[model samples]
Target: MAAPITAALLIIGDEILSGRTKDKNIGYIAEYLTGVGIDLCEVRIVPDVEDEIVAALNSLRQRYTYLFTTGGIGPTHDDITADAVARAFGVGIDHDPRAVAMLRERYQPHELNEARLRMARIPDGADLIENPISKAPGFKIGNVFVMAGVPAIMQSMLDTIAPTLQTGARMLAETIEAEGLAEGNYAAGLADIASAHPGVSIGSYPSFSTSGFRNQIVVRGRDPVAVARAVAAVQDLLHRLKSDGVPH
Candidate 1:
């Protein structure tokens, strides 16, 4: 079987770090990539500093099949994502005619001031990712994709880039709820099952709510058969634990 395609996300914004702006793009992008057969393997949140963005961009873009960056591409003064992306690739960035034309469709000549024109900048040799909601275009350079921070715009850009991405086998997943069972009780058994099925990934997640505490075991893999086998093993482990009256 072919190896799974992987991607990483770099979320850049001072507002996110400062808790001024809440992030809503990560989950959306993760589901979108998963549905399209690309695994989102890693995610990083960085401040709006140019150096930090450039460093993170360089690191992630090289390590993963694709690197997606969100935030820091707006028209504001702190929107330095484009410049940082150019520096990372050692490429020249300027107001691209294509991006300018796209922006022009939304903004009149008099309204296209210096601040708004900043949205037209594109890195050299990069392809523009279309934005249906807003006129500002995202860009793709090498394996790195730069997009907006706003969830609506980011989702739109993702749709635009989806066709261009090289996808692998779509990952399959199974979820089993071990209600009234604690993760610690199944940790060892889950480790053994994961070891036996090397192709599948097993994870135990515990959640506490106003009603009570519950644990859910999720098994994921590229192969449906492997995932099913892992899920069955997990169920069997849980059944034995329940029968043994193991402490929850």
Candidate 2:
């Protein structure tokens, strides 16, 4: 059996909590992790407070194989992700010489102030995650990767660290779309089919249509053969239902 690689996302921004800014990182990272054979199991949105951020970081970092955080590591006063991360790990946060030098090389003296230098403050013994869109880099302490608030910057930083992360066997999914079918009618058969295929994950999607209700079932598994078997099993269930005088 292949080992499971689970991931969690921590969105650190009061804007998301207050509904001022819609959080897009969770969905984006979830898709990315799924593409790379990592399952994203949990996502949390925390405010700018130090205690809350530290507690969330500590909880998620140890619980999952990989923990990803976005937002709050910015030039502004409320950006305290770095400080909170350091506190969570019980390490002191300081401006790395390399990061400082990189910042100095990229920006003029006036642009490099206390606020801007805050970006360079990384937790001790942490590796840096490169930000292609923005010069300010993100850092990885233990399993937690602290990234930027901007979607573009966060995405680019994720790309740099994804290669180093451990991934599970890629899951294969087969989608079956049936028109004008009520999910309630298919429930018993669906349950039986799913029970037969223990390795497969079967999900039923229902939607409203002009003709009637529509149902789409997707069967997913890490093993290709098992996924195919499960799809066949679902098809057999549908065929049996149709044969029993149920209009599908």
Candidate 3:
């Protein structure tokens, strides 16, 4: 099998860090990447500081197959992600004619002030990611994709770049509802099954409601046969425990 495609997300903005703006992009991006068979390995939220953004950008870009950054590529003084990305990659940054043209479609010549033109500044040699909503393009330099902070625009940008990304083997999963079974009753058995199936991952999720505890065991793996084997073992263990009249 080919090596797994991995990615990391760097969320940049003081508003996110300060709780001024709640984040909705992380979960969306995670699910989207998962569907495309790219594992999102890590996520980091950093302030608007250029140095901090540069450090995180350099670190994550080197560590993962791809690094996606959202927030800080806007029209304000605090929007410094482009500059930091250029700095991290040791490249020059300036207003790209393509980006400026895209922005001009939404903003009139007179309305294209310095603040708004800030959105046109892109890293050298980077490909522009079209923004269908606002027309202020995102950019891809090296393995890093710099996107907008706004959730809607960020999602659109992700959609635009989806076709270009590399994907690995799709992860398969099976869920066994252990409704009347408590996790403590099956932890050891689950561990044994997990050890038996080294290629698969087994996890138990328990939720509490007024009635009692509801447990769900999830088996996941890149190999479908491995996942199925693990799921069967977990089901057998749960069935045996229930037959023995183990209490929830």
Candidate 4:
């Protein structure tokens, strides 16, 4: 049987929930997963606590085809992702020699301290995910991929892993910008269009101009043919609006 292409994100940290940091990874991950045809079912944010991490790990990993965890893997006092994964999986976490060796090669003798190598710990039988920006590698335990929290590093890691992921057809998006129209005026028509095309995601974004509000109706779907047809219909609807030609 083919492995299912469903995924979930476990964002771990106290900083995120406490509002010390705004979680940027969730949005990026959602977009990335959508692009790769993996349906992102859920997003959970847990504190740096071990028990909390363990619970989230167990729940998400078991439920989703692929579980991606962010944060709590740094070389700091708070980093608890490795230990949590071990507990969740009913296994032991050990400092892998390969990870240690990589760290040794990257850092100067004095720089590679014991605390810095805290990232070397990995669950038994897990594979390491490549980290180009920083030598501290992320690892995969079964279907769970542990990645960095930082946007740049996370993006790089995602790029490396994305090619190996199974993705369906790319989603097609059609956007037509209308010069002058209030969102309220088009909301009903957009709702009708949205209902007509169940598979398509239609949106109306309104922007203000010198004249008045301008609405851009965007329609998107996985099927290109359906999107194109919907887009033409939207254009035809817009043409009938019969706007007053105000001199610029």
Best by TM-score: 3
Q: lDDT by residue for model 4 over 4-108, one digit each (tens)?
A: 378899999999999999888999999999877887889999999999998889888889889999998889999999889988888888899888887887899
* lDDT tens digits by residue: candidate 3, 46-97: 9999999999999999999999999988899999999999999999999999
lDDT of 4: 0.84
- Name the lDDT value of residue 79 in candidate 1: 95
TM values, all candidates: 0.95, 0.94, 0.97, 0.85
Q: Looking at model 2, which ten-residue stretch has the lowest summed lDDT?
A: 177-186
Between 1 and 2, whose lDDT is larger? 1
- Candidate that beats the other on TM-score, 1 or 3, i.e. the better one: 3
> Model 1: runs farther than 4 Å from truth?
none
Q: Determine the C-alpha RMSD for candidate 4 after optimal superposition of all C-alphas.
A: 3.5
- lDDT computed for candidate 1: 0.92
Task: Answer with 1 or 4, whichever has the higher lDDT.
Answer: 1
What is the TM-score of candidate 2? Answer: 0.94
Residue-wise C-alpha lDDT for candidate 2, range 1-248, written one tens digit per residue: 77889989999989999999988788789889999999999999999999999999989988999899999988999999999999999999899987787678778999899989999999999998877666899999899998998999989998899889999988788999754456877888889888888998999998776967778999988999999998988887777777776755
Evaluated with lDDT, which candidate comes out highest? Answer: 3
